[model samples]
Target chain A: MGLEHRAKWRINIYAWLLLLPSLIFLVLFTFYPVLQTVILSFYQADLGSPEPFFNGGDNYRIMLEDDVFWKVLTNNLWFALGTVPTSIALGLAMALFANKALRGKGFVRTAYFYPTVVPMIAVANIWLFIYTPEYGALSHVMEWFGHGGMNWLGDRTNVMFAMIFMVIWKEAGYFMIFYLAGLQNISKELYESASMDGAKPWTVFRRVTFPLLMPTTMFVLIIAFTNSFKLVDHLVIMTKGGPDNASNLLLYYIYETAFSFWDQGMASALTVVMVVILLLVAAIQFFGLDKKIHYN
Target chain B: MRTVVKGLFSVLMSMALITGCSSGNAPATGSQAGAGAGSEAAAGSGAGKASGEKTELTFFYPVAVGGPLTKIVDGMAEEFNKANPDIAVKPVYTGSYQDTTTKIQAAVQGKTPPDVAVMLSTELYTMLDMDAILPLDDFIAKDGGSEYVNDFYPGFMANSQVDGKTYSIPFQRSTIVLYYNKEAFKEVGLDPEKPPQNWDELVEYATKLKKDGRWGVEIPTSGFPYWMFQSFALQNGKNLMTEDGKKVFFDTPENVEALQLWVDLAKKHQVMPEGVIEWATVPSDFLEGKTAMMYHTTGNLTNVKNNAKFDFGVAFLPAKKTFGSPTGGGNFYMFKGIDEKKQEAAWKFIRFMTEPERAAQWSIDTGYVATRKSAYETESMKEYVKTFPVAAVARDQLAYGHAELSTHNNGKVTKALNDSLQAVITGQAEPAAALKKAQEEADKILAPFNK
Candidate 1:
């Protein structure tokens, strides 16, 4: 018993030795910056001003009541809701479909994933041409399809969905890779056992396959939700958060508030709020997935 | 768990490593031509001798000439080093006007404040108001006050000065003017020399200018509508903001009427393109003659001169109540916390860069309006003088020109207005509702400032 305790102590020491560098790094980069941002959100705009001061919760109060701030928040929520599930579902759908035997399967998979490899900004340019109100290639294709063109990203009513469509297209392929991994990890023995019991494919999938893929789904959903809040490059090029701030997500608003508006205080406040929101989601993922996680 | 945390940290480090290396090499591959243009500016200057001896000054500037622009700006350090033998100037190319602002805040908070920054004129007021910049009244002592002040056109000065103290000097500035395709005007049988004088006339003229396979007019619907709105509101004798500057008063009758006038040119008239997002290469539009009239900066005249396949003429934008246009350029402001020596070095660079002869050369080379009156009197100015007389108009309009409704939070409120303007023009909303919503939104946006 003494030997076991001694051995455990040695292992604990070893483990801490290995973890020290990361702990130090996290303190320096992530945790410290977050602390700094929180501190800054309380201060007025004197990050480098000749006179800097702490203004209590004034910045937070301002952000909370601001109309455009609420609009931007709503836009972000809409963007997240629009982009996240669609991408995950489509990704899973494509992954499941592609995991089957098919002719030229590799080529088809490669073609589907092509948009993911391209830079978001460059792809946004192509989508801009597609979203143009007149003589855009997308509109031209629509015209050829025997339909009149709708201004994809230009009209305020149509724009969030338009951006969501582009986001789904670019991001679904990326998310599919994870789903593909999850699909590949499922044991063939389970399927064989289910088949021997005269289980249908759908029944087998519902009972065994999906539950096995739960961790991956949870991971993918967390990532997709985080990304939906973060990604707004296309909005920068295509809509510029307009025709009336329709596509202005939280991060884009943070950028606009900091750079375009030159309000670093409010921007930092917005950033803290976003970070808190993300942390809540992360917390949910952490606790909710722990029970369902089956390593074996 | 220990290994997992370690792995994540390593991944993050690798990401940082990749980002740093890639950004360092960015100028080599991406935007090299703009970088090359910046290099010409930095080319002649030599870096300071040894690290300890040189007073290091960091600078940020946005340039049309990319690579050469940095080199030219850093060249100031070299020139200053050679002249003073005590200072080093490191000029950072801060991509666009927007990027410079972000970097400035980041760098300052990071405790490595740049000694000098070449800021957009619109940016100067907010920074000055925020106490982000150091005033240079002492630096103006070398030149005579009134004569020196009178040298540049009045509008140029207004863009630089706030309250009573001068905060910035015009570097490369321009006023928005009408760059019309002479060929398009001729095709429409409208007198190229006789431009419209009112909003209705502007609509009529644009309608006439519209032709097959091309647009009639294009307003860069994204960024610059504020300047145009300010111009018209000033012309209409309406203030976009109150004097104390802590309220939303843009919904006033005169401003509504003025904004309606401009919006009518697009929505009701259908004479202009609906959603040309920005004045992305306005001269290119003029060159292609894609639009009959290009309402853009005087800084773009060189581009028009270079690329146009057809003849073009510059004309004053029509006025309603008073003739006016806002000054749009940049200012050279020294940031705080630098040693007196570094500040002096920055001033020296600004002085050399803005010398009448140098300003003239820059104006001739890049089509930016010369900020120095003496430069306008030079032989180089004679040709553009005979051709456009815009320098005079831009100067004359200084009495009427004001900065865009700018405050620390002006960016949000202004964007709300600009976006609503686009919404109205694009038929997303009617003008009355759009303006009403914009006013409501802007009030909510400005509520913090009011408090």
Candidate 2:
């Protein structure tokens, strides 16, 4: 018994030793900062104030009443609603197309995945020129179609839609790779059996392929939802949440509050709200949807 | 049970290791580039101690205008270091004015601020509130007292002082001016030699100049709408903020009329675009001949001069009640908490950078209006002005210039006004209602400072 216990003890030490490196980083960068942000949310700290003071729930109360906060939050939801399902469906369709035995399959896959390789900031700058009024590439395209002089970014009504379209173009290709991987994971025998039973391609896709891809879809949904809240680099380069905050999103608002306004307490509170939202979304996906997912 | 206990012990051991590593790593990467520069300067000073004592100073500056301004700044620093071998100045480009301010805030919080920086003049109140910058009165007194301070243009100096104590010295300063395509003016049947001189003429010229493929005029309303709006207010017979920086006059009747005229340029006259005109793109639009006239900083003179394929002219913005613009740009400020030796070196660096000949060269090199009045008297400035007569238009407009809108809590307050202007310009809100809302917001923001 003593020898057995010693062996187990050695294994435990080895396990902890291996984890220590990443564990320290995770604790320092992630856990500690999260805790600090939570604590800061309860304080009143602004650049004007000499020192930070406890303000209880004042930050939260102010956030509730803050018009910009609500506008950005609503914008984020609309952005997610617009981008998530469409990108996922588009991703799946592209994956199916690429999966078929077609000529130049590699070229098609590379072309589909090209945008995902570019950094977001560079992408935003490229799109900035593309969307610029009067002389932009998009304006020239619009002129060809008799819709010249459409202000893609300057008009408040169209700014959000423009941002949503750009985000979808950048993200759909990324989600396609995951769906492609999931498609390859499904047993070939299942498809063969279905085809042998005289199943049409559309019917086979509906009844066989999509159900097997549920796990990837759920994972992609969570990623897309979180990403909609996380991405704000484009805002810095593009519209800057302009035209009366039409294209503003949650993370960008928090950044402006913290860095630009120097309202640490308010920014922390906003961050807490964002974290809670992301957590709730992830929980619903992992718990509520996991039970219904058909795991192969 | 024994395995669990051993695991807990190992966890504590790993925690200790983590803390040890982090503490060891903190100084190396704590404050990003600032910390790295600090250690390098420290090493230089240590090495210099064995020879003659040397003070290494880090100077942070932002490039708001387009050009190879960073190269100019670096070259100046190298010249300074060569001229005064005992002091070495390292110039760090910290991006735009906003990014530089943010970086300084972070550095100050980390207790590793650069020895000197050139931040926006409007940041005076914000820096004072943070207690991060030093008042330059002592340096000025030691140099030449009023003689030194008075050499700077009074209009540009308006934002550099508070309660008779100077905090910053003007460097790259500018005023809003009308940049017009002379070729377009000729094509529209207006005399190329004559630009609009009043609001009525402005509308008439713009209406005549508007074509299907081009706008008549574009005043950028996206990035710094409040700055552009301040010109309108000043032209309409009011400045946006008081001298003390405690009160704002955003909702006055004059201001309302100014905003209404701005809206009418697009809505009623159909001369300008209807929505927000991006600040960075307006100059490009003018260069492309898509806009006949543009209201932009005179600092862009060099850019427009280099890029324009057609003849262009610079003039004072068309007056409403009077010709006016708010002086804009960065000023040299020494950070607080540095040693006396470093402070003296930094003061020398500032003086060297702003000498009349250097200022003239800078103006000629990059189109910023020379801050020192005597800079215009330099032979180089005279020859350049004779060759390119429009280069002096911004300097001539100083008599009508005022301070940009700067107040306590400047960021939020400015944003309030900017949002209101954008809303009105975008036709989402009425001018009266939006300006009134902006005034209330600014009042609330300024209330604490008033106390």
Candidate 3:
């Protein structure tokens, strides 16, 4: 009995030893920064003050009145709303069409998945040349179409929409793969079973496919929404929140505040707010996910 | 079970191994001064050998836009290393002026501050305020180059010194100069030699020079307006800030008058094109013969020289009430915690770079101006910098230079100026209202430091 007890203790000790490296990484890379950020958010830090002094949330208060902060936040929300649903719906449609017996089906699948591999910053560079007010491919096309040139990224009103359009173009392909996987996982017998009961194609899809794909849809939505919040890399290079802060997004604004202004305190506060937003969004997604997703 | 045990054992071994490696790689201690055992160990090659051990030092420097400077520094370092064989200077190019400052701050706080750093001369004060930089007076005296150091123009040296302590030595110096298209001058039939002297003549000639696809004068209002403001204030007999650096004096009559000319050039006269904020490509524009003239740093002269398809000449920026041209340059600061030996090495590099002959060669190579008075007489410096009555006027105007008065809060000030400039150009606000609003926004930011 003592030997068995000693063996149990040995197993427990081994488990802890195995996890020790990972635990260290979590503390050093993740928790340490989260702790640092929390401490930083309360102070006013710059090149002058290497270590910040306690400013007692003045950074947070200043953020409230900051018009650029408000602009960036609204721009982020606009980006998320604009890109997510459009990409998801497009992904689902493409997945459904590809799932059916269609000609050149394999080629279509590869073609639909191509944009996923091209990086956002690379795509932005291509898009930048394309949208140039003077020497752009788009401008040339517009001239061919008997319309004058347009400033796609240069126009304040059009910049967000332009960025959204590019994002949707890039993300739809990536999201479709998940839908395809989900579609493949759905029970085929159920579809035949519905058909035998004289159910219409629309009716069968509405009743069967919709219910089954809920899990995948939720996963895609969660990933896509979070991605939109985090991914504003194109803006950093393409626009730099310029044409008068028109296309600015939250994460880019955080970077600008920290690096450009040397205001680490404000940047950290912005980061905290972003984290809270992401947490709430993720929580909602997770809660909803449990309602529909089932294990085999 | 054997496989699982093997995996578990491997994981344990790896954890121990990695931790040992990482701990060993942490920021080295006392290696800078060669005092302690740890320091000697870090000096790496050999304590047993006859001479001294090789020391490793990091230089935190800004990467230029798309970063050619890093490559240049790296190339120079490789050459320097080959020549010396004992000393190694590792240059890390960390983004722009702003990003470099942030990085230096982080390094300092982390207690692993860089041995040497290239800093924007304007923000040298921030480091000085924290006593992050070492005073070079002792270094100069130790070198017995007291007279040699004094050979630099007193006016040029003022920007590097604060309260009798010289914290930085100018790495590259440039003052704003007027660049004109010779072809445009000829086309307008205005004698390129006799450029505009004051606001009234500037407007008149700019109007005459204006034609289709050619702006008379161009100013990049967004990125840094202080240069433009400095030119204006120097002419108008005023400074942007108080000497003590406590308060901003924008929205003053001198500034208003200066900004009014900017507005008149853009909005009222329509000589400068509309909706053009950054003169990012003004050099290109002038090179391509799109704009007749631009006011920019002497640093841009090389690019103009390299790319200009037509003859161009450098002139002093047109003055108002007096000749004020702000110094546009950067400095090298020894970061705090850089120990005595490395500090000595850093000064060696600075002195080598700033020696009048080196100063002339580098200035000619990079189109930087010779800050040292002795370098002015060098043949290379004289020949490379194309002569003009305007350059002389610009040199005379150097007496009025106030260093760029931007703290870390410079971004806020930049924004205010950008916003006001945009308003005036876009006809969103008239010059007075726009400047007033700018002053208000600027004051709001300045109030914190004021308190």
User: Per-residue lDDT of B1-451 in model 1, one digit per residue for the tens?
Assistant: 0121222224334434545554543321112345665653453242333335666767788885323556555665566567766666677788877677766765544444577887777676467555567766666765446566668667677666655667677887777777778787888798877777766677888888876546677666654466766777777876566544456566677777876776666667767655434445345555666678877777766666667888777767777777666667677877765655566677777777787777776776666778887887777677666765644555444456555555445676678778777766567666677778878877876665565
TM-score of each: 0.82, 0.92, 0.79
Q: How large is the interface RMSD of each prediction?
A: 7.5, 10.9, 11.5
Backbone clash pairs for candidate 3 read B234-B324, B235-B320, B235-B321, B235-B322, B316-B390
lDDT of 1 by residue, A3-108 (tens): 9999999999999999999999888767766666777688776323445489899999987777778988888888888889899999988888878848877976
Better of 1 and 3 by lDDT: 3
Q: In terms of DockQ, which candidate is stronger, 1 or 3?
A: 1
In order, candidate lDDTs are 0.70, 0.87, 0.71
Task: Report the lDDT of model 3 for residue B442.
Answer: 76
Chain A TM-score (model 3)? 0.89
Displacement of residue A157 (Cα, Å) in model 2 is: 1.0
Q: Tell me how many clashing residue pairs each candidate has.
A: 24, 0, 5
Using TM-score as the measure, the top candidate is 2
The DockQ figures for the candidates are 0.21, 0.41, 0.19
Root-mean-square deviation (CA) per prediction: 8.4, 6.6, 7.0
Write one digit per residue (lDDT tens) for candidate 2, span A89-116.
9999999998894899999999999988
RMSD of 3: 7.0
Where model 1 places Cα greater than 4 Å from the true spot, the runs are A1-3, A39-60, A96-109, A145-151, A188-211, A260-265, A289-296, B1-56, B64-68, B71-87, B211-213, B238-249, B273-278, B281-290, B383-402, B419-451
